[model samples]
Target: MKFDTTQLSQKTQTLSPYSRLPTPCSLLPLLKLYNKTISQIVKLWNH
Candidate 1:
């Protein structure tokens, strides 16, 4: 239920260096897109 920034940053360090981009932004819409895409993919697979 609670989000942890330290854990997330540590996880992302394994993937890339931090200086390449801006910091985090509003993610509500990004999560919506992710949910939509997942459902769409599931529907495609079922069809």
Candidate 2:
């Protein structure tokens, strides 16, 4: 199986609470996404 990380960037992501938005709302989402991605990669390598 092949993984293309560049593809992830190609997908458009909303600025998501950039202006006039709660701070945690913006940060938490990103932290979650990063954790999930890291877990997935770890699983793949472990297998």
Candidate 3:
């Protein structure tokens, strides 16, 4: 089975709480963590 990661990007956009945008460098770590959490959830669902 193939995992669609594009959905992850869409989900991340909605899940983010910031009204005003921060610099990309600052957001990188938070985005990484969010993506990691999403990946873990997907793994759990696959099992």
| Residue 20 C-alpha lDDT in model 2 | 44
Error of 3 at 4 (Å): 55
Q: Is candidate 2 or candidate 3 better by lDDT?
A: 3
Worst 10 residues of 1 by lDDT: 18-27
Model 3 spans > 4 angstroms off: 1-20
Give one digit per residue, the lDDT tens place, for model 2 in 3-45.
Answer: 8777665542343344446688778999999999999999999
Which residue pairs in model 2 clash with each other?
Answer: none
RMSD of each: 13.5, 18.4, 19.2
> What is the RMSD of candidate 1?
13.5
Each candidate structure's count of clashing pairs: 0, 0, 0
Candidate 3 residue 18 Cα shift, in angstroms, is 12
lDDT of 1 by residue, 1-47 (tens): 89999999877886676555554565677888999999999999999
The top-ranked prediction according to lDDT is 3
Candidate 2 C-alpha error for residue 38, in Å: 0.3
lDDT of each: 0.82, 0.76, 0.89
Best candidate, TM-score = 3
Higher-lDDT candidate of 1 and 2: 1
For candidate 3, lDDT tens digit of each residue in 14-34?
788863568899989999999
